[model samples]
Target: MEIVPIDTPSLGDRSYVVHDGEVAFVVDPQRDIDRVLAVLRDRGARLTDVFETHVHNDYVTGGLALARATGAAYHVNAADPVSFERSPVKAGDLVEAGEAMRVRAVATPGHTFTHLVYLVESAGEPPAVFTGGSLLYGSVGRPDLLGSEHTRELAHAQYASANRLAAELPEETWVFPTHGFGSFCASAPSAASSSTIWRERQLNPVLTRSEQSYVDEPFDAYPAYYDHVAQLNLAGPGAPDLSFPRRAGTTELRRRIVAGEWVVDLRHRAAFAAGHVTGTLNFGIDGEFATYLGWLLPWGTPVTLLGETREQVARAQRELARIGIDRPAAAATGRPGTWTAGPISSFPTARFADLARAWQHRPVAIVDVRRDQEWRAEHVAGAVHIPLHELPGRLGEVPGGEAWVHCNSGYRSSIGASLLAAAGRRVVTVDDLFERAAPAGLDVVSRQVMA
Candidate 1:
C-alpha cells in the first residue's frame, strides 16, 4: 500500500491518494484535480473511490468532479446536510477497495459536525488514517470556525472526538490531516507534515485541556468570506465552470473598472509599488496569494486580472481555483501601457533606515498588516494593526496622517500601501525587515507568546 500527500501550499491543505497496487482512493481533493489524475497515471492505478472528510468550509472540493471523471464512488458523511449525491458513510463502517485496501470510517465531529476520518490498511500492514481538519499534527482543528452558537456544543464534541481517536487508535497508527502549517483551520501550527497517533497524544494540548477552557478559545475574527463559503458548499458547489474568462481589451478593462469589478494586479511587490493600474489590488503572483486573495475578495464579486502574460493570468486563476475562486470576469495581460488610458501610478517605498530618519521629523502613521499572532509577538509601539485582508472594509479605523505600511515582510505591506493609495490616502510602504523597527528609532512593543 502507498499513500501520497498532495499539498496545496498556498492554503496549507493536503489531499491524499492511497492505493493498493491496482486501485486508488482520493481524500479531500482541491477544485483542480489535474495533479490528482497525474498521480494516478504515474502510479498506474485506477481511481476507484473519492472520500470527503466533511463539507469543507475553507475551499471547494474536487471530489464530485474526480469521481465523475474516473467513475469512482464518492463517499461522504451520511449526516451532512449537503444537496449533492454522495455515498453515505457512517462511523465504524468498513469499505473495501482494490484487492487488499480496506477503509474504516471514524466519525470525528470536533472540526465539523459531519467530519469523518478514514483509516486505511492493506494486507496486515499498520493502518494510516486521513483525519481531514480534525486531529492535526500538533494542535487539533479549531472548533469555533463554524460559529458562536455552535462553538460551545462543537468544542465539547471535538474534545470527545479527539480523546476517542487517541483511545481507540493504536499508537503506531500513522496520522494524516488536511489542515496545519499556515491554514487558519488549525488551532496551532505544527513543525512536521505528518505524525503518528502516539506523537499527537504526547504533544497536543487540545486532548489534555479541560473542555470548558478549550471551548473558551478566543477567536479574534474569521475571514468575512468564510461566512458565505459554508452555504455554498452545502448547496453543492458542483464543479467549477470549465469555460475560461475572455481577455479584456483596453476599452473593456476600463469599463469593468467603471462597473466596480476588482482588478487583481499580479505583479511582484517591487514592480507593483514602482507602477501599477490605479485602484488595482496588488496581491502579487509570487507570494501567499491564495489565502489573502480568497479572504479579501468579496464573495460572488466579479474580478479581472492584470498580469504580464497569459500564463501569469492562468497561473493566478489556478491558485484561485484551489480556494473555490473561479469565474474571473476577464483577464488583461501585459503592463498598463496598452491596457489603460491613464499613465500608471507609482507609490513611494522606504526601507527601515529611511523610515526611521524621517519618523523623527514627521509623525507618520505606521500600519502593520500582519496576523494577530505576528502582531502580538512584536510590533512598532504605536503602529495601527489592520490585517491586509481586513484593510478594505476597515479603512476608517486607520488614523488620518501620512501612513507607512509594513508587515513582517514587504510583500503584504506593498499590497496594503496600494489599497491605501487607491482609497485616496497618503501612504508609503516600509518594504524591509520588521525587526528593524527598534533600530529605526520606534518603540517596539512585545506581547505574550501565542498559545
Candidate 2:
C-alpha cells in the first residue's frame, strides 16, 4: 500500500491518494484536478473513489470534478446540503475501494459540524487516518470559521472529537491532517511536517488540555475570501477555467487602473517597489500571492494581472483559481515601461535600521499590518496596528504623516505600502525582518507571548 500526499502549500492543505496497487481513493483535493490525475497516472492506479472530509472554507474542492473525470464515486457527508450527486457517507460506514483497501468514516465534528475522518486499512500496512481539519499535527482545526455564534459550541465539540480519536485509534496508527501546515483553518501553528496518533496524543493541545482551556482559544481575522469559499464548495464548483486571458496593452491597462479595477503586479516586492505601473497593487507572485490577493480583492471585481513573463501570469492564474478567482479580466507581461505610457510609480524600500534613522529626523506614522496575534506578541512601540485585511476599510484611521509600513517580515508591509501609495499617502516599505527592530534601537513592546 502506498499513500501519496499532494500538497497545496499556498493554501496550506494536503490531499491524499491512497492506493493498494491497482486502485486508489483521494481525500480533500483542491480545485485543480490535473495534479491529482498526474499522480494517478504515475502510480499506474485507477481512481475508484474521491472523498471530502468536509465542505472546505479555504479553497474550492476538485472532488466533484475529479470523480466525474475518472468515473470514481464522489463521497461527501450525508448531512451536507450539496447540490450535486454524491455517494453520501455517514459515521461508522465501511467502504471498499479495490480488493485490498477499506475505508471507515468516523464522525469528528470540530472543524465543521459534519466533519469526518477517514481510517484506511490495507492488507499488511498499519492503519492511517486522514483527519481533515480536525486533529492536526500539534494543534486542532479552528472552530470559528462558521462564525462567532457557533465557535464556542464547536470548540467544545472539537475537544471531544480529539479525545475520542485518541481513545479509539491505536498508538501505532499514522495520522495525516488536511490543515495546520500554516493554514488559517488550524487553531494554532504546527511545526511538525509529520506525526503519528501516539505523538499527537502526547503533544496536541486539544488532546492534552482541558476542554474549557481548549475552547478558550482566541481567533483573529481570517482572509475575507474565506467568507465565500464554503458557499462555492456547497454549490459544486467544477473544473477551473485556466485558459490565458486576452493580452492587454498599455491603453487597456491604463483604462482598467483608471476605472478602479484591480491591476495586480506579480513580481518581487523589491522589483515592484522599484517601479510598477501607476495604481497597480503588488501581490508578489513569490509570496503568499493567492491568499493575499483573494483576501484583498473585492469579490467578483475584475482583475488584470501584470507579470514579467507569461509564465508568471499563468502561475498567478493557477493560484487564484484554487481560491475560486477563476479568470483574469486581462493580462500583460513585460517591463513596467511597456505596460503603460504614463509615468511609472516608484516607492522607497527601507530596513528597520533605516526606519530608526528616519525616526530620529522626522515624524513618521509606523503602520504595523500584521494579524492581531502577531501584534500582541511583539511589535515596534508606537506602531499603529492595522492588519493588512483591514487596511482597505480603515485607511482613514492611519495618522497623517509619512507612513512607514512593516509586518513580521516585509511581505505584508510591501502590500500595505502599495495600498497607502495608491491612496496618495507618502509611504516607505520596511523591507526587512521585524526581528531587526529591537537590535536596531527601536523601542519594542510586547503584551504577552501569543498562546
lDDT of 1 by residue, 1-451 (tens): 9899999877778999988768999999887888899999999999989999988777778888888888999898889888888788899898898778889999899888888999988777888988998888877787888878898888889888888898889999999999886677888877796789998898888777787888877755556666566767677666666455688888887777777678889988888888887778788888878777778877778888888888888888888776677778898888878678887888888988888777788888889999887887888777899988889899988889889999987988988898888787888898898888778777787775223
- Which regions in candidate 2 have their CA more than 4 angstroms from the true location? 448-451
Model 2 C-alpha lDDT per residue in residues 391-442, reported as the tens digit of each score: 9999999999899999988999999999989888889999999889999999
lDDT of each: 0.83, 0.92
Model 1 segments more than 4 A misplaced: 208-210, 242-244, 448-451
User: How high a TM-score does candidate 2 get?
Assistant: 0.98
Locate the minimum summed-lDDT window of 10 residues in model 2: 442-451
Q: What's the C-alpha lDDT at position 345 in model 1?
A: 86
In angstroms, how far off is 308's CA in candidate 2? 0.8
